[model samples]
Target: MKAVHFGAGNIGRGFVGLLLHEAGCEVVFSDVAESLVQQLQQADSFTVTTVGQHPTTTVVEGFRALNSDQDPETLTEEIASADIVTTAVGARILRFVAPSIAAGIAARPAGAPPLAVMACENAINATDLLEQEIRANYQGEDLEEKALFANTAVDRIVPVQAEGAGLDVTVEDFFEWAVERGPFGGNEPDVPGITWVDDLAPYIERKLFTVNTGHATTAWHGWAAGHATIAEAIRDPAVAIEVETVLAETSSLLSARHGFSEDDMASYRAKVLGRFANTALPDPVERVGRGPLRKLSREDRIIGPAAALAERGLEHEGLLSAVAAALAFTPEGDEEVDRLQDLLRTTSADAATLEITGLAPDHPLHPEVRALIAARITGP
Candidate 1:
């Protein structure tokens, strides 16, 4: 079997690529970075170092690189004939890659075995969104029969590594990649380490509300506290308390919404917090809090669950507090952060809130967020 994966970055190589290679597939990584492409092309393989109690290194091979910009024909051809396709590119970049995917699906040889397309992103129904993008450009016959798009919920911590690490990726040992099996036209792809499920909502929400929400909570709060790394920020008593509170709020919401047992949710929250505190990972607060615009959006980790909580008349103060911290996040050198600050500066509180988060002025949680941002501007 062969697989063509987009993005040869940390998560791509360490998590998705590693698993795909272990599943006995020849992995072809497609990226726009000339340096990274050349690195992957020259190096026979790279290393994956898992950071945890029993840290171990594994050699990941059976993979090469293709520069998507320079080699569109080869990329499309690879995708056309490959057994499967996957992407770890951030969700926002999905649209940019959609044209290539559409081209590849169009170029797929007739009567060839069906292709499985799974988007391993942090966002909910990422594959569905990617498929929507692909469908926009597709005008080919029997596209549905020719391809399967499976939505996936992937949870792993692939932090930024030290400079000059080359293709070597250091990541957390704990990971989860769940895919909805309902989309498959026939037998599901037998990729090991993936949990195939009929309904993916529960799993997706569980990971999003627990892992992502908790991580963002830590990052925003940690940034507000002027801590450089997640380990340092999480070590502070106040920061840790705020993170736990946000997790508690989201946990209650998740348990109630998804029919998850409160006890199990509690365990999950604790485990996620433990991961955040792992010193070996040492993720920078600025890196985790980089994309403030997306992070502050309504459907994202912070506001999504918070809005649901408000609709339920449940406790969401912790999440709202995190929102305030996010507003205060002005990490230097991030263009998005600069733009967000400029928007917040020029617009009214309610207007800025609506524009940034897609929430109406009358949204139940809108006033709370506005008031929090207001408090940050004026002395409480």
Candidate 2:
């Protein structure tokens, strides 16, 4: 089998690409980074270490580079021949990668193999956005029927490699890749390499609420408590207390929404907590909390799933505090920091809160979210 994956970054080589090779597929990674592309071609393979006391190396092999810009035709051929295609390119660059994908679609000849384009991004409805971009390039039947996309949820804490930009990456062994149909408003399942289920909502919420929420909790509390890393942050009593509180709130939401039993939820939380405490990761506060604007978007991080759950009559105040902390995420010179700071400065706290959070002006939670932001700015 052959697979074509976008983004030759850590996620491409360390997570997905590594797994694909282990599953016996010859993988070709298409990337926009010129240096990264050269690195992959030169290395031919790289290693990913499990984040634990006994750090183990997982070798990812057989994948080479196909530059989308310099080798569009080469990229096109790979996609056309691919049994399945997957992407780990960051969400913001989806539009930039569309044309290369469109060219790939154009290159397919008669009896082309079935193709599935799964965007392994962190967005709530990532595949929805990715499919939209891919479809925008097609016309008529090709747009409607030529291909398929399966919305998926992926969770693996692969932090930015500290080894200074080679194919090598460090990641936690715990991973979740869940696929969905129907609510994606589509018919028929497409391709392989995913765990397709009828409802993606439950799975997505579970991961976002539990995993993403915990990671962010570590980041925010970690930063405020003066810890340089996630591992260190969890050691602080205040940070741990806050993270536990946030997880409880998230658990309530998940249990209400998914019918997950309390015992099961506890086990899940324990496992996640275990993952966060991973020593090999020692994830920096900056890495997890890097992009304030993106994480605070309507469809990402704590706010997105939290608000959605709240509308469904689930607990959200703890999440509201998280959103507030995200706003207080004042890392010097980070563009979103300036943007959020400006919003708070130029507008009323309530209005700035409403605008960034996508909350209704008169929404009951608006008051709570605003109060939380006020507390974060002034402290405890």
Candidate 3:
């Protein structure tokens, strides 16, 4: 078996590529980073170190790399005959990669087994977004016959690599790659790392609301409290209290909407918090809190659950606090953070609230968000 995986970064190499290699598939990494692509092309192998309770290292080999920017034809050819195509690229990047995938699908010969494509991104239904982009780019008939797209929920914490750690990744031991089974018709890729589920919505929500939400909340609150790393922030009693409060609010929404048992959510919440507090990971607050605007979106980690909770007349103050902190995140290099700061400075409170969170004026959570933005704009 062969797989074409996009985004040869830490999550792609450490989690997704490692699992694909273990599944006995020859992995082809398609990346636009010239240096990274050249490194993979020249190197024989790389290591993935899983840190935490059971620390172990595995060497990944028998993989090929292509510079998707300079060698599109090669990548398209690789995708044409590939059995599986997966991406760890951010949700926003799927559009850029879609045309190549569409070209690959068009190049496939008749009667070929449908290529299984999954986007292992943090966002909800990321593969669906990829599929939409591919559909827009594809000119061939019977698009469904050429590719099978499955939405996935992936959870793995990959911290910034130490300097000079060439192609090597250090990630937390805990990882989950849950894929929807209904899309594959029982012929899912032979990836042992996957937990195939009949319904992926609950898993997606559970991970997004708990892991993503808690992680971002910790980062934002941690930044506000003058903390550096996630471990440091989560260990701080004040930050921890705020994060737990946000998780509690999201937990209630999950239980109320998804029918996830209270006990189950509590266990999940505890495990997630413990992961954040893992000193071994040392995820930086700036890195996690970089995309403040996206995190504050109406359907994203903070606002999504908060909006739902508000609609149900549930308490969402904790989430709103996180939102306020998110607005205060002003990291140096993040484009989103720069844009967010600009919006806050130049735009009106109501306009900025609607623009940032995509919340309508009549939304149940609108007034609170607007008020927060107004406070942020006016200052103390």
Candidate 4:
């Protein structure tokens, strides 16, 4: 078997890349970074280390890079030939990978075998979104055998490890990728390198509510406090309380919507909090909160649950307040800040809040966001 994976970053090498290699698939790492690409091509292998729940290092071999830009011809052939394709590229770069996808489709040989493109992103609708962008340029039989875009929910704490020469990646050994196999079809959870599940809603809701939401709450709350590390930040009562409260907000909506029993949900939430409280993990709050803009998007962590609550006629004051705090993150060189500033400056408070936060102007949570902004903004 052969696999072509996008993104050679930490998650790429540590999770997806290593898993594929172990599953007995020849791996072709696809990335845009020239240095990393060259390194993969030159070395033919890399190393992955799990930093959580029993740290261990292992060498991953029989892999090389397919420089999509420089080696377009090869990428096209590989895409057609490969049995499976996966992506770890942050959702924002999904478009940039479209051309390579089109080329690969064009390069598929006659009677080419079916392929799957599993986009392992933090969002719920990632695979569908990628298929849309990838199909914009595709047509005919190529479109018919068009790869499957499997919606996947991945969970792990892969903190940006210490930078150095080796390819060792420190990540939590506890990881999960629940792909939306749908009612008709689902992922092969039993598959050596994949976990297929029917009805992605439950799995996604569980992971996001537990990992992403809980983790971000720690970040925003942590950033508010003097702590830099996630473990340190959660040590503060205020931060811990805020995280627990937000999780409670999400847990209520989740249980009501998904039929997760209150008892089971409580246990799950406790497990998530325990993951955070593991000082041994030493996950940094800044790293979790680094890409504030992406993390704050309507489809991403903070806004996703908020939108869910709105649809079900539930109150999301805590969620909206968290988003309001996210918008206040004025980090230098962040495009989201620039975009948000424009929206805030050009629109009324109601419209600005809705526009950036993805809630309707009349959303029940909108007033809370307005109040949050008011209390924080020092108006003359």
Candidate 5:
């Protein structure tokens, strides 16, 4: 078996690529980073260190690397004959990689088995977004026959690597890669890391609302409390209180909308918080809380659950508080933070709320979000 995995970053190498290598697939990493590609091409093997309760190191080998930007034809050819194609690229970059995948699909043999394509991104239904872009680029009518796109929910905490850690990755031990089973027709990929599910919506929302939402809440609130790392921030009593409140609100929404049991959500929430408190990870607040504008969008981690809860007349004050904290996240270097600060300074409260969160004037959450921005602008 062979797999073409995009991104080649920490998540890609540590999680997805490692799993693929274990599955007996020759993993070809397609990346645009020239240095990273060269390093992979030169190295015989790399190590993935899983930290936390059961710390262990595994060496992965028998992989190839390609510079997608420098050698599109070779990358396309590799994708053409691969059994699986996966991506850890952010949801926004899916479009840029779509054309290459489309070209590869077009080059496949007539009777070839459909290539299983999954985007292991933090966003909800990220593979659906990739499929849409692939469809636009594909000229042939048998797109479905050539490729299978499965939406996935991937959860793992891959912290920033220490300097000089070449292709090595340090990630938390706890991880989950849940993929939809509908696309595979009972013949899923031979990846032991995947948990095939009938309906991926619940898993997606559960991870997004709980993990993504809670992580962002911790980061934003941690930044507000003048903390650096997630471990330090989550350990702070005040930040922990705010984080728990936000999780409680999102937990209620998850149970109400997804039929997840209260007990189950409570256990999951506890486990997630424990993961955040893992001092071994040492994730920085600004790293997790970067891209504040994107995180604050209506369909994203913060606003998505909050908007749903508000529309249902449920408690969303905790989430709104997180929103306010996110707005105050002005870490230096993040373009989104700079943009957000500028947007708040230059635009009206109502306009900034709409532009930032994509909430219309009549949205149930609009007035509250507008009020938050208004307070930020004019002072509490």
Candidate 6:
């Protein structure tokens, strides 16, 4: 079996690529970074270090890399013949990869076996969105017959590796990729470590609201509190309380929305906090909280649940507090932070809230965001 995986970054290699290799598939990495492509081409394999509890090392071999921009034709060929295709590119980069995927599908031999295309992004329904973009370019092709696009929710804490680690990805051992299997027509991909579900909503919301929400809350609060790393901040009693409080709000929403047992959700919350406190991972607060604008968007972690809860008249003050902390984050190196800061600095909080979160001015939660922004700027 062969897999064509996009994004040669840490999560791409450490989590997705490693699992694909272990599933007995030869992996072909497609990346736009020339330097990374050259590095992968030079080295036949790379190391994935699993941190936390029992630390272990796994060497991923029999893989190749192609520069998606410099060599699109070759990448298209690989994708055309791939047994499975997966993407770990950030949600924003989904469209850029779509054209290549479309060309691959267009060039594929008629009546060829179905190709499984799953996007392992952090966002909800990511592969569905990817397929939508691909269809825009590969019109007239019956994608349902040619490929299976599976929406997936991936959860893993692959921190920024130590500088000069040289292709060795350091990641936490805990990971999950819940995929929607209804579109597979009973011939799901043979990849291991994937939990296939008929309805992915419960799993997606569970992971998103718990893992992602908790991580972002810790990052934003931790950054505002001057803690540099997730482990350090999670260790602090105050930051930990904020994280738990936010998780409690999200848990309520998830339980009400998905019928999850309160006990199970509580267990999940505890496990997530333990993952954050994994000293071996050591994720920087700024890196985790880099994209403040996207994080605050209506469909994203913070405002998504908060807005939903507000509609149901449920408690969401914890989420609002985390949103305030995220607004205060202006990490030095992140370009998006500067953009977000400028927007808030120049415009009224209400205007910025509308533009950033995609919330209507008349939204029930709009006033809440405005109030939080005011509180955040004024302090206490």
Judging by TM-score, tell me the better candidate of 1 and 3: 3
Q: How many residue pairs clash in each candidate?
A: 0, 0, 0, 6, 0, 0
lDDT at 364, model 5? 89
lDDT of 2 by residue, 56-132 (tens): 88777777787798998889888877766788987877878877776677667756644667788877778778778
**Mind giving the per-residue lDDT tens digits that candidate 1 earns over 1-380?**
89999999988999999999889899999999999999999999899999999998999987889999999999999988898899999888999998998898888888987889999987888898999999998887678878899999998899888898999999999999899988874488879878898899989988987788777778888888889898888889999988888888888888887788888988888788888889999799988887888888878888899999998999988888888888888878988788788876676666677778888877888888877755544221
Writing each residue's lDDT as its tens digit, candidate 6 over 1-380 gives 99999998988899999999999999999999999999999997789988877889999999999999999889989988988999998888999999999888877788998888999988879898999999999865477788888899898899998989999999998988889989987888887788889999989888988888899889989988899999999998999999998899999999999898899999999899999999888899988887888788888888999999999998998998888888888789887788887776677776777878888978889898988765544311
**Model 4 CA deviation exceeding 4 Å by range:** 182-190, 310-315, 341-348, 373-380
Ranking by TM-score: 3, 5, 6, 1, 4, 2
Assess the local accuracy of residue 64 in candidate 2 as a C-alpha lDDT between 0 and 100.
Answer: 71
Off by over 4 Å in 5: 378-380
lDDT by residue (1-380, candidate 4, tens digit) is 88899998878888888888888888899988888888888885677766566778878999989678788888888898888788999888888887788678767776765577778777777877888888886754566565666788888777767758456676777778677665224434234655767678888877887678888878877877757788888778988888887888788888887889889889988878877777766776667766666776666777778777877887676777577657665545657666665665566666555565665667665666666554444323
Q: Candidate 5's residue-wise lDDT over 70-161, tens digit each?
A: 99999889989999999998887899999999999999998999999999998888999999999999979999898999999999999888
lDDT of 3 by residue, 1-380 (tens): 99999999989999999999999999999999999999999999999999888899999999999999999999889999999999998887999999999999999988999999999998889999999999999987878899999999999999888899999999999999999999889898889999999999999999999999999999999998999999999999999999999999999999998899999999999999999999988789998887888788878899899999989999999999999899888878899998888888888898888899999999899999999999877422
Identify the runs in model 6 with alpha carbons over 4 angstroms from their true place: 374-380
Root-mean-square deviation of every model: 2.0, 3.5, 1.4, 2.6, 1.6, 2.0
Comparison by lDDT, 5 against 6, better one = 5
Residue 133 local lDDT, model 3: 96
- On the 0 to 100 scale, the lDDT of residue 62 in model 5 is 97
Candidate 3 Cα errors over 4 Å, as ranges: 378-380
* Candidate 3 residue 314 C-alpha distance from true site, Å: 0.2
The top-ranked prediction according to TM-score is 3
TM-scores for every predicted model: 0.96, 0.88, 0.98, 0.90, 0.97, 0.97
Q: What's model 1's lDDT at 210?
A: 78
* Cα-based lDDT for every prediction: 0.87, 0.75, 0.92, 0.75, 0.92, 0.88
Residue 318, candidate 6: Cα error in Å is 0.9
